[model samples]
Target: MPIRRGSDIGSPARTRSRKKSRRLWTAGAIALSLPLGLTAAAQGNASSPFGDEPELLQYEEQFLTLYETIKDPANGYFSDEGIPYHSVETLIVEAPDHGHQTTSEAYSYLIWLEAQYGQVTGDWQPFNDSWALMEEWMIPSADEQPSNSFYDPSSPATYAPESTDPADYPAQMDPDVPVGEDPLADELSSTYGTDEIYGMHWLQDVDDTYGYGSACGGTAGDPTFINTFQRGPQESTWETVTHPSCDDFSFGGENGYLDLFTGDASYAQQWRYTNAPDADARAVQAAYWANQWASEQGNAAAVAGTVEKAAQMGDYLRYSMYDKYFKEIGDCVGPSECAAGSGKSSNHQLMSWYYAWGGALDTSAGWAWRIGASYAHFGYQNPMAAYVLSTDEALIPQSPSAGEDWGNSLDRMIEFYTWLQSAEGGIAGGATNSWEGDYGTPPAGTPTFYGMYYDEKPVYHDPPSNRWFGMQAWSMQRLAEYYYVSGDERVGPVLDKWADWVVGEVTIGEGGDFQIPAELEWSGAPDTWDPANPGDNAGLHVEVTAHSQDVGVTGSLANALSFYAAASGDTAAQETASGLLDALLANQDAQGIAVPETRGDYSRFGDEVYIPEGWSGTMPNGDVIEPGSTFSSIRSFYQEDENWPQVEAYLNGGDAPTFEYHRFWAQADIAIALATYTQLFGAEE
Candidate 1:
């Protein structure tokens, strides 16, 4: 059952004032307190331990203040086990359904946040601790996946046809469908001396809100691995049927949730986990920065252990590059027609949506499965992580082929960006080996990346994955970072065009008000790739259909501009980044910077969840699941949320409810952006 509002069920909430006057030190006060030489440094005369400008000192103060707020026990940003929650507020919903439910994305941000902290304060303990916390809680232990030793390289997983509609499931598992070999399994196991994967699972019910207990039979209140979004592209978070990652007959209907998603003659109690490669890659990116900053501070040994672990994670992340079921890549019209791949033929050399592994709970059953994703989104590629994993000796993977694979991936990723770059500078959606997620035929004239078909929105389509402006900011920020570090000539022109377009969309008004691109509209598609003579993609374009002061995206945009400006010496990008940081600083609350979000999507609370007729189940909380059940009806605990009253009112003819959510990822992004600005452009100019 969900923990009741105001109950002392999880972390204790302490009272914190929203006012900043009590927490932050004024610039005048900071200047007055500094010694003679430090005061001169503040006046832009000489460098101090922080920096040589008052603005830089101010940014450092802002970062420290924000970091403290995030770390404060009263804020409830973290669980008792030291794992960060998705948000401080428990009554919100987004990609993770419940705010208490944590994601690997949040953990990656935590790692990055601490790395920035280490850079600013010359303290690496927090950075190391953050990585340790993620490893301990997010990554499944060996015991949680004991049957991995039974996995076979020859056959990965049985094939199931993917559908756009939730009603089309339970997709039948067809063993007759051919699958390719798992080339990395034996090598990875041999290198690590363990069959178990070292990657973090994408989602976790940190407070056991769903009462699924824990993986491999632990009690409630422990962090429980869970999953959603299994139906298909059309299935939104509202349409999901939440189920434990480690399925036993103890919860849900007979056969657990397996029968609800995939139709098989029988079901087994099993453990499954999915890795969001972008998140793991972000963690590695953070490690690379942490190593760089610590080495600068003469504290390289402090983060050495965590950096090594990040390399190992990157090695395992290679799974995300392969086609789902390891099917041969490119130009396949049917599931069976697509030949099973023997080795690297299945590898896309780009980060895809996810890679998953699973096995039976009863080890004696001796069956396990692994599969990679076929779709590659432009937003998921992290060239910085790829560069570090491939080139940085301190962070190179232990596996022999891992570095070479990443080196190839880095080149492929850059080329992918070039291929997808729109006439207006925005990157378009990505390519898929198995079109429509099941090797379906693409319409004639649909552009191809290598042999793969281009998709306007590769993964989820509930909102069209590329429809949000955040994707541009997040992906381009990594590109900007790569350009900053590598100074690659090919990257400069791409960054110049993108940074110009982004700055054109931004509008910083008087006072603290600002507008950045929010919703986006896309038209036209890129021309088919010819690597020897790449197409100009002049027909592809993106339009900013909406604008808002979304603090998180603004932070990301600011960070992107900071790196681009630092590398290209663009004063416009630098000034715009400064303005954004200043705007964000003005919007501070007790928890972190946030703007009020009107959740019009809450109307989907009453949306019907498609359950087959005569098929029934019970949630762990005892809510009945049947054909008539709505999204909120099956997860009745949501009704117990303190904010549910407003949602109920909205459902009963009231206005849409609004919330100022202090999401962990958003707060960390904002804080890290501040530190980034100081590091890059905070010098006296």
Candidate 2:
């Protein structure tokens, strides 16, 4: 049975505050002591934290209120389903299946908050309540099916919808509508449309391509692949969009990775669909911490069970994912084996990379020809994998009998990192030997899909993939954690290299703004705001710009760098983080509510529209132009309209802004960073 609120069962004996001096930091003191170029109203300072103790208390209270507001009381987690406001009051979820990470972050923050209170007041009340949350919501009971447990099985793979018929998708009101050139038909289908195990409840209306393009849901003109049946086995689903070569794997298995995806092929696909290792890494990390909490209470069973879960996740990441790739595909081969431009670690670098199942098939192995044609490793997914492995050796567990010892796991990470370090002092997110430059005459015996040979050079490989600063921030954070846990001096240099790059490339100057670079080059870059415009380095920083700068992405990096600076004594890294936090605070909406506006990277609904293809012309005032515009120059609704402020008003003690585009991550990341900063630096000293 699910644990209920007010239940005394999980509460630990309460104690008085351990460190009275640290109990509360006044915001007023922080405002006075803050260094130059820093904003007093942003996050609090390390010394005395948030200027006033009440501000910090208020921050916590507001967070809890928002958490309770958005949480699905039924399941005891934040709901990503339905309209954006209906779910979280702002920011609609483009893919509900992918929204679990945001919810996981929410829970993680709650635990952090409770832990903070526990450290400060010696009060176990908040800690006990938060721990109860995990038991009541995260853990699956004995009678519960593994599928019912939100935390047990990994994320379900998402499929492009196959139906275009309006009648078949009655769940979506106004299904047959069109947004400009893009038809709403593709929005109605799903990659899981053929699967029986997944019902309509699993597919949210906003799941399709965030309401863009015909390829989002299914083929616009083709009807052969329309989703007609729902209650069938694995055989009913289309393994590939058009490929006959795709084979089916046995549906059920004891393997975590296999079982999570294949056990129900009706709900599974040939490939893993999710991106970013944050969810997977954070889930295991939370489990580790939960085990620590359980151990403190002498709950041996809970401790063991949580550890086992964490280790299992590690096994899947290590053996099935990271290790398997490294062993099978070493870094790089000679030109005869690899493409022309292939280097030492190019092939084996990005262990965290992943694309949706059959996405490679859908794109016809568009980028990487030899290996990448089959595997579309992403840059954002692996740092957390490194984090999980480096978190604890117990979390590492024993490898398969045939597999090597646990130390090799860290060794693998070192190898991956060596490949990650670029000449420019930054870490690139992904690298592939798919291009002719990566591999000349493709390896023999390569698999074929959709009547296309994986050996041929594809147009997608001509221009190499660019690094993502957001992902690098994740890597930097992971590196910090790794240093903290392992106490390995080696990681410090790595941190310096990446941190230096961030300071030099991403930051405007010593006390200026932080900008995330777009994936494309100068002319083809995504549209975003440039703080340095009209100054010394005016006109959009293309080579060193990001899609958008927000608290979630930037604050995450700040937290990680803070940890690194603490561990490594890197003052430059610390200074950079301070500047970043200042920038984050300075970007708040009218209500002192800070968050990231949508950045232009992939989708362009609220961020930036593709010039002539999606829109055209300038405003009557010539202040805004659509076509031939860089992401920095384009104006978006997020920049102009979004500010709806119920949560902000409640938390910050002010009225809600008129606009609305809420992102829980922004709040969570900032809170996490602030808490970490307070813990590390807050004191009477």
Candidate 3:
């Protein structure tokens, strides 16, 4: 039977979901019901021959095996044939934190799948289906938010929709909630004073309050961006409650990254109501939409949409780097910047060095070539582009203080970049920058690093989130990349800080026992806040939100281990990676639905659990791991059914010709470590 996801059922609707799932148990059912059959290449290419390589043949077999279980093109999201696609009517736990459009997720995965699987199956079906979300969200006019700069854009920074109303959501009524329940009321109960998974339900609240903008459902109040003084930290986190501007003018808030966070706490706090920066979400959704393109629908539109989203991503990235970073003047910061240029990393200043420091290989400056041709819209990857994505960059001393260069990328390179930022972060939240060092806690009302940045105090965080510091490995990693590529002198110490911090924060024993960070109270015991000491970094724990033992802490440490050990001349770093790797190895599942018997690198097999009634049931707090649990997020939503084939293919060397599958920072680190060992210690033999 289809393994029950959350609550022995699926989505938010509990009735008969499992029963319907049971019908399409066998892989054969999915292949027969959906579009897994031999799909002819477009036009005259239909007669093209199938795979000839052994790797291709192996990957193809795996893909065919997943014929069933994967979502069918029945007009809904990832599902098998005739499987009722969950709509607003049938929601999985109150919609998720930031995934107002999970289809974007489908699209993102689809892009990865196409790069990894399409060649094996000669299929564009999956990629096409993933992009289907464009039909509803990615439109010329619909893309822009009301009063957003893209729309009216009166002055330099002023945006008409500076403050959003909480009562409005999803434009109008949504079936996701109870039939007649007041969306505002429902959302209030969800995000209000809580950082639990349900807190994300605030997404709908923000959309209703603010109205969906161009960066439609991309990200909301992402902590990484929110913390930056560039955006002016003084703005009221709660759009409905306050409107305080540092500068005399508006901040074109609806555009760029501001629209990611929700004004209301009841909905998915990460559920971005606005959608101005449309590239990321759209590409992600296009990946999911690709699976459903098995029909006569040629996949052209989907591919084109995917390409378009990539283009937009490229443009936005350049805008962010050249224009936004170099030129923009905010209240807290001025137009003038560090003379060191790319060599700055103490704070959010890391963004400017994205060309050489940030892991922009996949999105920022080098996103185009890193992704593919359609992705070349970032003008094109020059010298620094390839450098950030690889060790070949020669390690420049862009930032003398931090050192290290070339972060991570999405080209199957590393998992740290992806997992460290979002693994424990829950599927519905915003991506974070880096983890907090020394396990410090934010003061009360100062926004706990749990997830959101503006709301720094865990006290203000009613329930408090666990996504932030938990997944901040990304920052350190990109810095290391910067050092490796740019040859910057600052990287040595910066790498040490990250490496040491990872070991200090996350440690594993002989067994799979993980030692998460527990900040020494000193003054602040359980809570990190202290009234006595003014401005002391009381306490912060990214582990606060990550409850699962799977990816949250483990994945981050693994990523840290990989990067720290990959270069550092220190034998201790290598030892740290080894110990962590051992624990990861112990958790491997041989017959797991996701990938094959994984040996060596753990990236091949991410966290994929087959809990019988675990997720399929209710939450301890009564809230379901709706939308999805952190477990699902780890594997990039990879499960045994259809997507696993590609995951397996990439993992087992069946598909990964180049170590590109090491695209994820964490995953790439593992690859880099292995490559290093092979060079020094020689092959395993």
Candidate 4:
């Protein structure tokens, strides 16, 4: 039997028993010798794709070494069920709030990693297996979301006013507030012949560490669907109250965890999921490369099924293009005053923060809801995936309108990037149709994109969403890829300026000691968008506030520079990219390339968690949740982690904890960077 099948049409049972031969190569060993498969023919003249250049060959060896380290069971990158964890360490906290927990972002990186591996080795099994694992574990099964058939298109979801303060929630769901219709529901269901969504949920408890168990009700220890970040724009991962996606009223307060985020007359056992569109788009981006590379090797058929599934995922990702409540796009102010949308009026045509859906757990309830996000972050846009979905015949979505939608999205995204570009060449935060996430009015003279208002920080405010330099690298890498593929004149200037700015900030010191921009500070905002004659954005600018040797961001930065160099023939970009890759090679370890990080944010471990007064609950492990609870008090699991002592000391007024983290996405990014360099510029003599 095939090792795994695609989940485009239907979900499949976990097929974790399949095994592939593993290559065992030490990082130190590979540095001294050529990678196993390279031959003289593979290293021919500059015209050859895989050149014999010593630096390129060394990068290939580095790629193989990182690949083996990631795949080696002893390295602990993968869980028992083959799902990749967010990071190898357990006590760390970031977007997912826990190191063991995984996100769709990590799954997408795994797919990208395997795709590069396939390109290098001509073996597609690992690529297929990674997608299968993502589908089996990250995407919820039919049983997990059994009532999607009950979803209504005309009325998507009730309006719940969002507040920046966590204390102000349980936001009441107001039925009187008008919401617009879902434009894609009927077509998507009809195209697939199933009401179920063919997308992965944004987050998952990979080890079932929170004890959410399976759909409806099941045992713990299996990978389970989970969610966080409910309170609003100001709610960071630190303030979130984690809960199961499939709440059965078995944990939390009387209404499970629902009442904590949204309030209604009553509540029922339910299942819900949020889709991070950027991650799904990246998976499609990876699949496009996989198909191109596989076809080059006369092995296109090996990954055809998975590519189809990626297209299916892209089809559903259209939900991210619409307004949160389908409100008419552009200058939508006031909740009731903002006219509800019809057809495509609500479409933002740019990738938003998230789209979500849910339904009652009871089979007979016949009620479900879906919602799109109103905020569009520049960092999440992927024109490369949009190009693939709109143009690739075999990879185009099945829905009749998907091609048109993605085509529009591709154009809109480029316009968005152009509009948001700052004087310093970095992209600004984003724009939103609903100001303050509630259709509130923006300050006077705030610039707008189409109808959406410019926001210095789009989604969350605790840590400004665009403050991380990693976002610039990730988004620009996609733009670079699109440029490499299309050579579109619109993208060339954006890449030129961005490459110059980022390359200026990168410092590759001797012996792999280097620093790239870490935290960024933005000043000024782009002028209102004018597609016919775009503004220079002379007033908008960015400053590098801090710098660090972030391994993952370095890899992504190198990837972006290489792609830009490949298309534009920028020697500066090409040299800097090669330098960054070479510097990273000096930091390799048994698990992966990484650097020590002093987590000063660990002090937030003691930060208070705002629970409603007179309301209390217990976690599955019997941790208490009440008004006085702090973040560390909730789960009580972190104290048991091997790295807990350092965090505990930091929480108890000691120096901040330092950890050498081996994040799955970081390892994958490093490997992909090496492979990308080999493919893009390796042939150069």
Candidate 2 stretches with Cα past 4 Å from truth are 1-77, 80-278, 289-304, 319-327, 330-350, 354-378, 381-394, 398-406, 432-467, 505-542, 546-548, 582-660
Better of 3 and 4 by lDDT: 4
Q: What is the TM-score of each candidate against the true structure?
A: 0.92, 0.50, 0.37, 0.92
RMSD of 1: 7.4
Q: Rate the local accuracy (lDDT) of all candidates.
A: 0.83, 0.34, 0.25, 0.83
Cα TM-score of candidate 2: 0.50
Q: What tens-digit string does per-residue lDDT give for candidate 2 at 1-685?
A: 0000000000000034344343222211111222322224334444322355443343343333333343334422344332221123333322221222223234444555454444443445554565455434332222211121121111111111112221221111121221011011121112212111110011111222211112223322211111111111111111101111111221112221122111222222222122223344554554554444444446535345445545654443331232111212432333233222211122232343321112121233221100111222223333434544554554654433212323444454554444334444554333233223222233454322211122211212212333234555655676666565456665667676667766665553222245754343322211121223211212212356435554566777778876666565566766666556556554544322344333221122222322223333332123344345533233222233233233224334543233233455444565556555554434442
Q: On a 0 to 100 scale, what is the lDDT of residue 105 in model 4?
A: 92
**Residue-by-residue lDDT tens digits, candidate 4, 563-600:** 78767768788778877887888887778888899989
Reference-based lDDT, residue 463, model 3: 16
Candidate 4 ranges beyond 4 A from true positions: 1-53
Candidate 3 lDDT over residue span 448-504, tens digit each: 122312222211121122223432343344344334434444345545654665555
After aligning candidate 4 to the native by TM-score, how far in Å is the CA of 34 from where it should be?
25
**Candidate 3: deviation at residue 667, Å?**
12
